[model samples]
Target chain A: MIKLKANGRERVWFYAFLSPWIIGFLAFTIVPMLTSVYYSFYKIHVFNMNVVEPTFVGFKNFKYIFEDRLFLKSIGNTFTYAIIRVPVGIIVSLLVAVLLNRKMPGTKLFRTLIYLPAMIPIVGSTIVWRQLFSNDFSLLNFLIGNIGLGPVKWSSYDNAMGSVLLMSIWCGIGPSMIILLAALQNVPVSQMEAAELDGANAVQKFFHIVVPMLSPTLFYLLITGIIGALQAYAEMSLLQMPGDSTTTMTMVVVQNMYRMDGYGIGYSSAMSWFIFFVVGLITVVFFRVTNKFVYYEG
Target chain B: MLKTENKQKRALPLVRTKKTRKLIGDIVCFAVALILSCILIIPFLWMLICSVQPESSLIFMNPPVWPDPIRLVNYKEVFFEIEMPLLFKNTMIIVVSNMVIGIAASISVAYAFARNRTREKNIFFSVLLATMMLPWVVTLVPQYIIYNKINWLGTMLPLIAPSIGGSAFFIFMFRQFLMAIPKDLDEAALIDGCGRLGILIRILLPQCMPIIATMIIFSFNGSWSDYVGPSIYLTDPDQYTLSIGLSKYLVANSVTPWHRVMAGCVLFSLPMIVVIFTCQKAFTRGIVASGLKV
Candidate 1:
């Protein structure tokens, strides 16, 4: 035991302070995580599990997930959404943050308003979006209609995923923008002035200086954004109707475990593990690929 | 000639005055931000407009921003659809319990990290942080099984009690804030016969009010906005938090009442807006701190 020479009881106080978290982590997080792994390899029926013993069916649940058309479609939808949503979120939020960073008169109030979407509950914002996107009375279509385009069927199979993406971007970017704006403050003002002195235009200064300086923040947003994107649940889950094509991976796991006639505990556990692995993989890949671009102010 | 040459060198190669250029910049920035912000705020304005519009206007066509004789009958319907007082009570229970346990334990865990130097603690802290990245879906079913096994499925305990373990994100934030405070402050308190808990409470906590306030707001809003947790555990309508209640209100029937749903949404978002307006500074500070690596 690599024990420090603390007065013998100091360690006692330390552990005592840690006990609540320790207890919680064990029972709630760590135990469940371990048990989920165990459950994934076993054919554990949902309601009759206490009555019926679970059989050890190694890799069977994994086999089911890969073969299940719904699972395949849902995972595909989630990644497709992430690929588009993550970049759009980053770019749009960065643009807004730059606009706010312009520090014009009353920009602060506008910043608050811009962030208001994030402050509102997702369900609330989504319900409002549902109304706005309702084909019968779509405000979006009305606005587009003025531009000589016809009404968009926002909830159609073709547009359902896009509708959710539109709402997600609106809500998601506010926080990212705030974070990026904070990072913007740290992007050396002296460098910007020098760039200006070098006769660099706005676009040149942004790409050359601001983007590089903000890469760390951008990278952080990317990883978290992808993580969040995979779990795009509430909006998609709420607005989901018959023939709605936006069932995300999180929704798949949720329904598989919770809904009636679900694949039961074993299958959902495998799916959860699959999600865990993917999240871990994406995070690892990001760290590996984007590390060189991230400038740490040493 | 030399002075003019120096002035020309410092000045921009432009015909316009600096003041005019700055004014132009300000207008351009504001115009762009204003247009985009207004675009973003449309949903909110739509939310507000729809909440007050009569059901007649909402059903047939897009509700106008100002309905002819604005009505608040939908807010009244939210009253009958769900017990607002009881709903708030149920939510407050989750919020208060989680905050009390989550904050205190987070502080204790953070205190240990900040003050207690141990080789194991560093690894422990890293493990703790790794948990934050562990998505809730991984634990959802097993935790649900555990809760069900213990017959806690229909109660708020599932939502509230897990937080007894200090949340990894908050603990990490608190630990960072604590580490920045000089070691000598707590050491001086120790010399003055203060106990560990006393030193933590009297010396450390007051200095961390901004972070603490931030946690309060975050935890409060988190509970308020939590749809998944409430939907999963609290199966009974009587026990439903505002999120579940509002969702049910929206989707309870085939013909969704747009006005009442918006009203419920407005009600759902009210406390959050108030919390933000009150603690906006603290939240921003916490977020800025959060983005930095510890």
Candidate 2:
């Protein structure tokens, strides 16, 4: 009888402790999530007195999204950005991590310097990058001009994505580099010594042993990077890069929802759902494929 | 003795040659590190230089590399011309409230997950993890509509209120940190007539100082830098955060003063840079722990 009462009390405590998250989950997350899905299927109208009546429109919002040229263009831009940014970002960060991992004088200072950019606010950093890439008075162009190259219009449609990618890589490389550096430190020194004894060159040792050991961290970074790239918004908006070519899906969605004419909430909700679906699919596919390659040290 | 001396001399030369090669490698490493560091540092340096220079210098065909008689006038303009003080106050209000509510809720829930063992707990934990994977954009429009309907459209409540529910990422991070604490501590507290909340408050929270600090820094930084959230909800000039306020410099007019914009950027980034430098070890540990283990 005493044991039963104690067990009952424990359950009560567990529930009590979990109450906040449970409430939050229900109100903010679960309800909002369901509402988004529902909104996606409806034509939501806000009356002058701020009354919201969502009428069931079935697949109309989805169909409109499909037909929307801006939406399609944003999707194309987003994909292109992700494809170029993710792999390149991973490689650059990994290389920097390796360089910083070296046991040398001033390595700590160098790491700190490298990570300073990541600490800057995204909006602030984007502003800085915009100035750096400005065509009229670009420091980058000035330096290149000295080398006899013509000035590049970095914020132009042709170079806008590239400039954004460059800034993203600079800001992003820090955390990934830090994580990879930690993973590199965790790699067994004895294994490297043994490889050296067996006459393995530095490149061979790095690729064959170190890379395998660090694959888990690498995989983690890759997944997160993809998700982050897909959600790219602040930089694009802050940079104010010209034309439809620079508009990401998130940017387009935000623009559509916040339009002064009326609430495009339903359509925007539909687009967000589509993005969520794509992200989910990509995550599923990545995990399925990478499970074969990601090494978890025993 | 002579033959032994000869062998020693021969071995010494090989050792010296190997040391030379190692020295060369170190030099190369140093060079690369220096170059990369310069690449990382130059942008901020450039911003600093540009912020102090006259607007005319920026417009010149060959812009002056160094500011002539560095002026503090642009920073003065940023403060006097712009609503910087109001923006700072608004940001602080949002950041402080969010941190307090967020940390309290996350600690409670994470403690429950860490200390309790039940089938439902396991299921809920998985649900929480799944929620982390769901993009914020998925919740963006719906949440906005809900907030708008509730008449929170022009208020900071939209930013501050949701954080009261606890963030999934922070909760997950706290849960991981709490799990690493030995269960024996919680059991001991329980035996001493402490309830679960008592154990969380008396036992776990004190040990979670590092994570708490990390959360504070992250929450502050996030709220400070958040442009999209503020831009979406706050339309009033008086209610704008630093981010939205600073962004105005870009879209203001054709003759936007780059110097003042750079000045705003410097001031905007200063706090975060200071925080990073001061609590760098904690910052790094938090990042590595959250990134790798999660």
Candidate 3:
């Protein structure tokens, strides 16, 4: 990556030009990131004078996180949510992209329609989703009941996460599909024709040619999607059934941010680290597993 | 086989089957795509419908597909129930601040990386891209504490101040776009005694309308729809953006006045819809471009 050809004047100009990003990055990204890591290991008490006196207790906060039922439960719920939602969302998006990639009528309109919901603010849509998913008052159950099915309790404990999962998938399908559609456009038409001439059907052609060709885009979506899913906050916060039923890993940390008591600072920081590590681990594993099969173009 | 082949030549039969298969495949795909798109878009449709429904008919035990009486008064009622102008004024403050400052900073940094040739620049560029993947949760707490420490809480500073540094995504985007521009212009600008900033401003920027529009749309929608930052920092109701206001509006009320809140919700996302559709090409390009970096 070295390109050390610029003269001293260019060096000065480079520094001059990048001052805003450098300062902002150091202030916003670097300092807080390190401070949070520091906070995670210590019991930080904020006193009246804006003085933070932290008492170091190495791994105690993390220990407490492992033992805390709420934390464990929240982590479990997050894993379960993402484990289901990520793959389903990806496959659904890929299928939609593949289908839409075919020459069909009104394909243009369908693309826009699918993508419109993704543009709506999650906070606003969650409000609408909450009201719409209420068991008796829901449009979903009402539509189902009209189709000769029993009204599913969308807000019940067993189904609350399911409803959010459904919504998450719904909101997610657009962007991923859009990405996959673009990637599909890049798939070699000659390769597709070769497979077709060899007597490959649509399903076989999709599984063999298209999936591998689109794997890099799919992997990108997977990592980002999982990262996003793990950071699920606003929707889980606002849309959960009226209780602590749907605390995600984010809420595990965020709940403490609201508490007036002081112990929460360290705990919240520790939980965030836990989320951070989980995200890193998942990214590594995904990259390793996908590296064997995914295609990357120059 | 012989009888069927007799109806048409063997070659003709093969072509018919192939054509029929493709026709069936297209039909099936059309149906599935239509259905999936409908399912995906139904909630926003419901929200739009609810915005016009009367208070009692917003969500129905037996929804009749359309609201009865279509009380467009709900739109006006939104203002009386909540401080619409104050919320909009507040939200637009963050959006415009982030848009103007964020775009400028990102473009400058991008230009620095694009034009500069240094090992450090290369390393910093990679770091910037990596930061794009770093989930905000890792920094959420310390940043909050920092904001609290700096007394930036209860104001829009926490929401607004971060953008002055530039965003990684936009910087990467601007850098990618800037790198694609031929260097002959920069060389000519240099020969003509244009300053570094002068070159970027005069020679490069006007050609970057698409990425700028993309950033503007993203920044506007991002800050406008943002609830988390404002929820964390802005404690005062007087400073609430519409998104935070919408989230709190439900809890702060008895039944949530769904019709009116739906009106608020519609207004909340109306600007986003307009911005996205108007700049549909850039919007999709941003998404596709950002996603393909892997």
Per-residue lDDT of B1-294 in model 2, one digit per residue for the tens? 979955765678777856666787789989988988888776777778878877634634455357777878989898766678888888889988998898889888887887776658888876775575555655665677788778999899988888766877667656655654446667867888987777777776665665665566567677878877998899888898888888876678587787787788788877766654454343222332232331
lDDT of 2 at B57: 43
Candidate 2 yields a Cα-based lDDT of 0.71
Summing lDDT over every window of 10 consecutive residues in candidate 1 chain B, give the lowest-scoring window.
B284-293
Candidate 1 per-residue lDDT, tens place, A184-296, comes to 65455566888989989899999999887777667667766766777666667555533545344344445344323333767677777776677667766875797577664
lDDT for each residue of candidate 1 in B1-294, tens digit (9 for 90 to 100): 978955764685564445566777899888888888888887787777777877634534653356656878889988777778888888988988998889888989988877885557877875774575555665666677788889998988899889888887678656655654546667877888899999888777765665676577668777888988998889887888888877786677688777777777788878876774565443232332332324
> DockQ of each candidate's interface versus the true one?
0.32, 0.31, 0.32
Please give the TM-score that candidate 3 achieves against the real structure. 0.74
At residue A141, candidate 2 shows an lDDT of: 83
TM-score of 1: 0.75
Q: What 10-residue stretch in candidate 2 chain A is worst by lDDT?
A: A252-261
- Residues A1-298 of candidate 2 have per-residue lDDT tens digits of 9988877877887898888888888777887788777877877764542428878889998888778777677787878888988999889988888887776787767776787676655545664666677766677787667789968988776788777788778777765676566556546566687897898987898899878877766776676677677767756765666655434345343534433234666777777777776766776688579857966432
Instruction: In angstroms, give how far residue B229 of model 2 lies from its true place.
Output: 2.9
lDDT of 3 by residue, B1-294 (tens): 869754554457687867876887788888888888787787888778878887644454355447777889988878767878888889888898888899899999999987887558977875674565444655666687788778887988888888988987668556655654547767877999989999888777765665576576667767777877888888888888888887787778766676777788888877776764565343232332332334
Q: Residue A173 lDDT in model 2?
A: 77
